[model samples]
Target chain A: MEALGVNLPFLLVQIVNLIIVYTVITKWIVGPIMGLLEKRRETISKGLEDARVAAEARANAEKEAAKIIADAQAEASKVVREATERAESAGKDVRAAAEAEAAKAREAAMAEAELERNRILGDLRGQVAALAIAAANKLVGEALDEKKQRALIDEFFSGVKSGKVVVVGESLSGDAAEVTSALPLTSEEQDVVKKNISAKEYAFKVDPSIMGGLVIKVGDKVLDASVAGKLEGLRSTLK
Target chain B: MKRVWARWVVLAAIILGLFLFTGFFGIGLGIKPIMPHVYLPGEKLSETPLFGIAGLYPTNTLVGLLLADIVVILIAIGVSRGVKSGKTVLTGISGAVEALLEMLHGITEGTAGKWTKQIFPWFATITLLVLAANWSGLIPGNETVGLIHHYDHGYDLKQVGPITTIWDEGTDDGEHHGEYAIVPFLRPVSTDLNFTFALAIVAVVMIQVFGFRSQGLGYLTKFWNTKTLFSKPIFGVIDFGVGILELVSEISKVLSFAFRLFGNMFAGAVLLFVIGSLVPVFAQSMFYLLEFFIGLIQAIVFGMLTMVFMSQATQGHGEHHEEAH
Candidate 1:
């Protein structure tokens, strides 16, 4: 044991030294290390918690932004829809007003055109009556009676014979009467036609297209004794 | 290019070292490497005891112990101060100590459970102290530079540039210079039986303390188990015998623990020098690496065994003993 250096005092010294080392280690090394570990664990957990909070906050922010954007889009669409409706309504009103104005102008133009045609046809009737009178004077080798020839031409053009409308066979009564003649009727001819058809109002029109006849309309009934109507009847009978 | 210059520099250094140490081609100091005398015990530094008492003289192992202690304490201070300064992590030696201790703490917690707080300090202390002592041996001049004393089986001393070294004359003829031996100033304390036995004794005592602390007076029943001695026939006698054997094993634990660390570290130190003397150059570097690994392993093993025994003592004796069987 002496050769191995296991003397009593040195062994004792080492034991005492061991105790001191144990004290130093426990107080300094182990205690601080444990505390540091615990603190590190705390720091890590706190970091994770902060990150979680930030993430949640970011998610909330994103949701709110999405909601705001949706609201803005909805408002924009609503504004756009309202603007479109207003524009369409404004366009519809302008179109309707324009159509009404066009219709009124067309009606005025038609009335003026009818008056002009009737005046022209009236002038043509006078010339045709004069020509017929001269031809009658030649055919008979003598001058025909002037008043009688004038009456004959008036009867042929107005479809009125001896101051009575030949087209009105039966007595007619109505709220209004419309008379269409081949030429513009003189006042005397209009008074004769009105006397045949009883109505509240009278309208006189001349058309050369009807040849030498008169057409009368009282309410819904019409009396057709125009030359053109006679020719259409002959054609149907032939077919 | 940088790496290439470094290699050339290393090659130059190796040649220079060879020339200086070996005196190759009759240049430089003539080589006279003396094999150091192997001593089992730590040689005393002086004839008079430091404490002014017989057998209380200072020894080279005592110097080694102080060096190891200073290293451990300095590291402890650095780690504590680093942790105290609110740093969760440390660097350098403090970092290394923290890493090692933290690993040890994890192991202790896994094994010792609640008793980890009580048991882990001893584990740390022993590992650090033994580790420091073992590694200190690897320092270049630890077993070489010392006080020369006259002896029958020694070498002649030579003075070169204010340094004294052991010299061997080439011829066997009696020379003008005398023979002498060296008592190295520093030796690894782990090679001392006193330190190992002291550590072992403390560890075994702590094991019992944990046993008593955990089980109270019931722990004594493990050594003198009269509870089942007469109740059953064959198994009761066997249990009594086992209890007595457990008492015997406790004493054996001290012997095993002490000698295990001592034998390994002392043998490693001796192996290093023996290999160095046989092939004095870079061959010993390989064995140094070997010694480094062995030192780490032995330190961990010593600490782990103590921790296991302590944790075992803290458990129910009957259950664990049965489990052991």
Candidate 2:
């Protein structure tokens, strides 16, 4: 009556309306939206799982590639080492073959020199005997016999100097040392001694079949005055 | 059939109880003024007319009707609660009542569904309550209280005819002077403008509430409804005039709701009173029947108008006007 102030009925109506609207919307709209959000959450989780699996697969592939590369590198290194070792061994084999061939060539040269020396010694022996008989006949004015000459040669060899000398004969006795005459020492000889003498001396035996010549050696220096040596010098000059 | 008879018996018993209560209070008591008259605030209770307005005022009948309306609405809600979704007594009543309300709501909601839902409950409740209050006054003895008379001047007196006065005025011969009296036995609620004005204020305030709830503070601008008033000078002037008009219209709603119901019910009561006074027996019965129908029709009209005005106030003016057209 007093201008119809706020009343219980109006308040009740407002409250009732609010409740009805809230209930209906909660049942219909909000519930459906919540369901949609739940589905979206599941989808996102499945997507995350798929991404994780893909990442793992990619990592495995990378590891396998790395392993293959490592294996290839190891194999390549082993091949290089084997090839290098084979090349080194081939070089060593070539060196060994060359040395053997040089040794055989040196032995053949030494045998050939020995055979030539014997043939020259045979010719020199005949010349030296003839020259000795002529020299005796000139000195005594009479011919001497071969036996007596042989005995005299022995006596002269035995009476010569006991130093190193060269004997030119088919065969030299262990005691043979004689020469036709003792030669004077020349300036050349002294020079040879100064130039060629070594601090340590070595003795060398020459098998010379030229019996009339005397050969003397001191270290590497040699003096030869024999029929074979004279005939080799003559042939060299004529040619 | 028994259930129907039982319901009628209960209704009759309640009616009888209300009648007996009224009769005991109305007829058994003999006061100095046998008929109760009211002195409104700022109104004199003398037999002399004040500014040509009636001197004898009635009790505030609107208060009782308002109280009864509240009780009726509460009972209606309780009864409706017993109703299930599609089946129940209230649902059947609602099916009949809702046909017209639904049609009105459809029109309001055609363009303003969003706003109407906010105000529909208050609008429907107010309409139904006011309607029930108005119609209840059509019952017998509602406007038929016995008549009594007071002295044209301000004195108590002894009785002159069959009507006995309880108080006397001094006489010239040292004897008491007697005065004639007339009194009635019933009164109707709506016959008073105060009751109708109260109802009108409730209806108008409810319209404002719906408007505010629907559109918030913007609803105040409905009185000043204009587009680009400042930009176009001539249209601005017209808009200003229209704003004044809108204000006048809102002021007129108080007069409209109050006077319409008051005039109708008062006229009906006066017609019945005149006819029954002229021909006591048959005219009383005939006019009583006429009053009953008039009361029902007026209640329906008042409720329907409240509903329409409230819906219109809350809804978009352009759409509703177009739909009305």
Candidate 3:
């Protein structure tokens, strides 16, 4: 060992020096660097986690917003559909009501026209009878009274109400008959017409434009015999 | 294939050119031819009385050891200062120190496990000190520049002048030319057995301390297993004999560790001297590189050995053997 210069004091000193270096390096250098690296890594990971959470929240919020918009759209469409259906139904009801009212007004106007035509026809017949009486007086030297004229017109209407005017004989077995005339038929005349027609059900109408005609309709058949009807028939025969 | 051959040709040409230049052109340029200077272990430049004491003197190796310590301490101080400055990232020399310490931590931790934190200091110290001491010789003036002493036909202590004036020329160049040898003020620290042995002793002592700490008094059973003797007589004798061998191995560890560092560093120094003498110029550079790696390897080997021994010592003999298997 002496040949190798193994001195105790110097070895001790070297050992001491080494220990000192190790202590300083460990305490001052390694400790701080390790800590810094660990801290930086942790901070980075935490930031990443926070970013991920924020992105997830954003996605969730977007989904919720989309759902609300979709829900609102569905609700709005449902409301519009209901409103459109309600408006269309109301228009249909109004159309139906208007058609019915127009039909009723047309029927009333027709009834009034028939009444006026019947009055006019009655006046013309009275005039024609007066003229005929005057001419007869001139020819035979006599005057016709009002009571006799009324009896002649009533006799003519009785023949039509009893269905005797019908050219083609028809079976009168139906439960109902339709009666049409130029003048309004009174309740007594309607009963007489019903008794003569021998039908329990009856429909009566007046159209003065027909010129003193009585038309009877039962099922698909019709009988017409009046002054206007005979004149149309003579005209058609002349043509 | 053509490109690869071209690259190889270029590499070969460069190598040949380097060899030719160092062999022929280098010498022709008047580079001085250096003679290998012979040196003995513990040779000193000069001896000075310790604190002016008449008979007490400090050896030159002691001065070298002190120089190594001062350098290491200054580095430690510099590193400490860098750390104290509170910089987030180490740079330059402090960075190197931190890297070295970090590497040491990896090595020691692998062997020592939990006790790495406790034993890493000693391991770092030995490695750094040995590495620094070994590398110190590569510097320009180490073991080269110092005072010169002149002696006549026969040299004697009484024939020399006062300690301070040892460099002074006492006699002129006359009929008899006295031979002289240089005594450098500083030598590489690892070349001194005293420094290496001191570090080894410290390392071995710490191993025992760790062993005691880990296994308590039971650690001594590795050196002497008295309980095994009565239980199994035949196996007990073998166990007892093995214990004695273990004790001798422990003592031998210090000597071997010391000599291992001393031998490598001392041989590296001689190699540098011989190479420097033979071609005094560019030739020494390659050897310097070799010495550099040698220094690094020796430092690693010494430190790792200490760590391994400390780790092994901490475990009981049976457990250590089992682990070895």
Best by lDDT: 1
RMSD of 3: 10.9
Residues A188-234, model 2: lDDT tens digits = 33233223333243232344344333454433444565556667889
True contacts kept of 2: 0.00
Native contacts recovered by model 1: 0.81
Clashing pairs counted in every model = 0, 26, 2
What docking tier does model 1 reach?
A: medium
What tens digits encode model 3's per-residue C-alpha lDDT throughout A1-239? 55655545545555676566567655654555455445656878999999999999999999999999999999999999999999999999999999999999999999898767766865665565566556766886665565674544543443343434332244454577888766555566667666566666898876655656577777776777655787889999999
List, residue by residue over B159-230, the lDDT tens digit for candidate 2: 558754445333456443534333433344465555566566766877787778766777766677455467
Error of 3 at B146 (Å): 2.9
TM-scores for all candidates?
0.83, 0.39, 0.59
lDDT of 1: 0.87
lDDT of 1 by residue, B1-325 (tens): 9999989986786776677668677786647555577787788888888777678778999999999999989988998999878887998999999899989989999999999888888889889888998888888888888888887767777787899877877676745255688889999999989999999999999999989999998898889877666776777789899899999999999999999999998899888888877666667878999999999899999999999999999986776665654
Best of the two (2, 3) by lDDT: 3
Ten contiguous residues minimizing lDDT sum, candidate 1 chain B: B170-179
| Better candidate by DockQ, 1 or 2 | 1
Model 3: which docking level applies? incorrect
Ranking of all candidate structures by their DockQ, best first:
1, 3, 2
- Please list the Cα RMSD from the true structure of every candidate, rounded to 1 decimal place: 4.3, 27.9, 10.9
Every model's DockQ, to 2 decimals?
A: 0.61, 0.00, 0.22
User: Which candidate, 2 or 3, has the higher TM-score?
Assistant: 3
Candidate 3, residue A109: how far the Cα is off, in Å: 22
Candidate 1 TM-score versus the reference = 0.83
